[model samples]
Target: MPKSNIMDTYGRFDVIFKKGIGCKLYDDKGTEYMDFVSGVAVNCLGHSNPAIIEAITDQVQNEIQISNYYWNDKAVKLSNRLTDLSDHEAVFFCNSGTEAIEGGLKVARKYGKIKGGNKKNIIIYMDNSFHGRTMGALSVTGQKKYQEDFEPLIGGTTNAKFNDIEDIKSKINEDVCGIIIEPIQGEGGVVCADSAYLKGVKALCEKYDALLIFDEVQCGVGRTGSLFAYKKFDVIPDVICMAKGLGAGFPIGAVMTNKRASVLTHGDHGSTFGGNPLACAVGCAVLDELVDNKILDKVDDKSDYMVSKLKKLKEKYNIIEEIKGMGFLLGLKLSIDVSEFSKRCFEHKLLLITAGKDVIRILPPLNIEKEDIDKFIIKLEEVIKTF
Candidate 1:
């Protein structure tokens, strides 16, 4: 390989994928590989999807993007569709997951000042949660490593233990403005929030006059067999930040706010290219495929099948310590080094993203069939047998 000009931010893999189809990818040399990472759970419908392609092609022929100053048809349609499905009444489109989280925070803080007599600016986040990497989003991200180098983060934030309601309650105060958490912690090893815990947090937020923000950037948009994971848990949040699968790899994100948290007046928050025509059109198409076409209808069944197979593997292989998460955003806790395991899987033409210390994430396309999962299991077995 020639000396690279790209920044060394990412620890990239050796193989450069040139093309991809459903649940599969092709390297520059045309070598086939099964994809379980799904662009870190972005390409929920799979790569080069017909609907997404058609939508983007048609959109480009007409218009791609315009300043948010003027309203656009596709953006309006997408906003309407999202609000209709979600509990929120308003939507703010952005470019990525981090931007969505940042926007949600701004909405929360703005609502707090207006509703809470402008006294509360403090926000609470949970341990092991990954909201995003941007400065505002990073402020709520619970991992210390990501925050170590970047000190003096957005102030008035506290980190509570995941699933520990008392820890959350202990940190809540009169000045608390918002509390953000992931319904399922994606970068934190696919940990799930306890249903009762989430309910308790909701009640506490209500009592404290704080906004509840659900960071569904990784687990939303049919990844967890629902439009959003919070909806599946049946716990309503004041603000919901979503991306990743929202555009099915088209690079779009959104922040939804309920009536109570809709305190941000005009000009409080804005994005130049947020709800651009092209991204919104792709978002609309993805929504259509997931909702109208009933692509997510079979997700629960598929997740069940995959989990059962993983359970069998756990019983047979002692290296398989545990299986965590729900639906397609699953993880395998391994006794062995997951980094090495993932590397070996990559060498074997199977892709897996490692999460946390020893968890291997099993994020496949939402529309992936059981047959593809079976193929994944077969490949996983081969990788383990030699390990």
Candidate 2:
């Protein structure tokens, strides 16, 4: 009944959340809801995790912000860990996924200029892919709805069909410098690029001397039962854009690059709040939980269990057309209106988010138990029956 000073950017529901722990959220009135959205794949370890809390507390007491002129141990440790975990050799830190996308684009363009000069600055993106909302990211993002208002985007960008290598080849040319894609399209109806298709893309990039960029902002950092989703495809990219789950619930982003794509030198790009001690400390804890605490090891089992139940729900409900995506980043492709269905689920106290127009995205915490998933299935079935 009252309006807040916050910008009306999101079509937010009326509920006011007060607290969260594990896979559940509590509203101001003490009503509990199952949080399957997990901050849209950001809370991989769940809300108020002890590891993350401790990391933040310890870092805050020592150092919160420092000039990038001098190195902080936390940032250095995180960079080393990230580079060690992935195929990358260098890292650039930012504050959000969109910032990460922006940095990756900069690296690609710089590499393009270095490799083939100004003429070879084209970036090829996949249709139905969702990269980010920033100007450069929006430019490469293949969805028209998000870009319609923000036209006159960055130059030399083109779109090719997802999972279509031939179409990608047709789009490629001598001036093309980069191809950026999401290994699994979380916001694009949960579409996944096939293994062969990714391999073909990599081959094409190699042949054309173009950099390959994987936007893993939503599906990376143990969300896909692997450290990186690109690993699942068995085709490595030259650059990886990561953010959502990197800092658990904290805001942090990174652009990692293999030796070939690490073109940016000193003063090429930077962020004042990027790689600050506080955020990198939280990122270290997330990585420790996923790698050392063996949290990533359990993701596949949880994914298999949840997907099985969702498949059964599809069999019973005519509204569900298909179950899409991999690992915790799954989706329900419905014949009904997804936005309305998501709103109904919200009323039912099951927090769900919709992808595109017809898919309800499921992005539960990576550490969520089978019991929580069981509860989600029950709530999902109850909502489906109402249709």
Model 2, C-alpha of 249: deviation from truth (Å)? 0.8
- Relative to the true structure, candidate 2 has a C-alpha RMSD (angstroms) of 0.8
- Residue pairs whose backbone atoms clash in candidate 1: none
RMSD (Cα, Å) of model 1: 0.9
lDDT of 2 by residue, 35-119 (tens): 9999999999999999999999988999999999989999999999999998889999999999999999899899889889999
**Cα error, candidate 1, residue 221 (Å):** 0.4
lDDT of 2: 0.93
RMSD of each: 0.9, 0.8
Candidates in order, TM-scores: namely: 0.99, 0.99
Error (Å) of candidate 2 at residue 379 is 0.8
In candidate 2, position 373 carries an lDDT of: 89
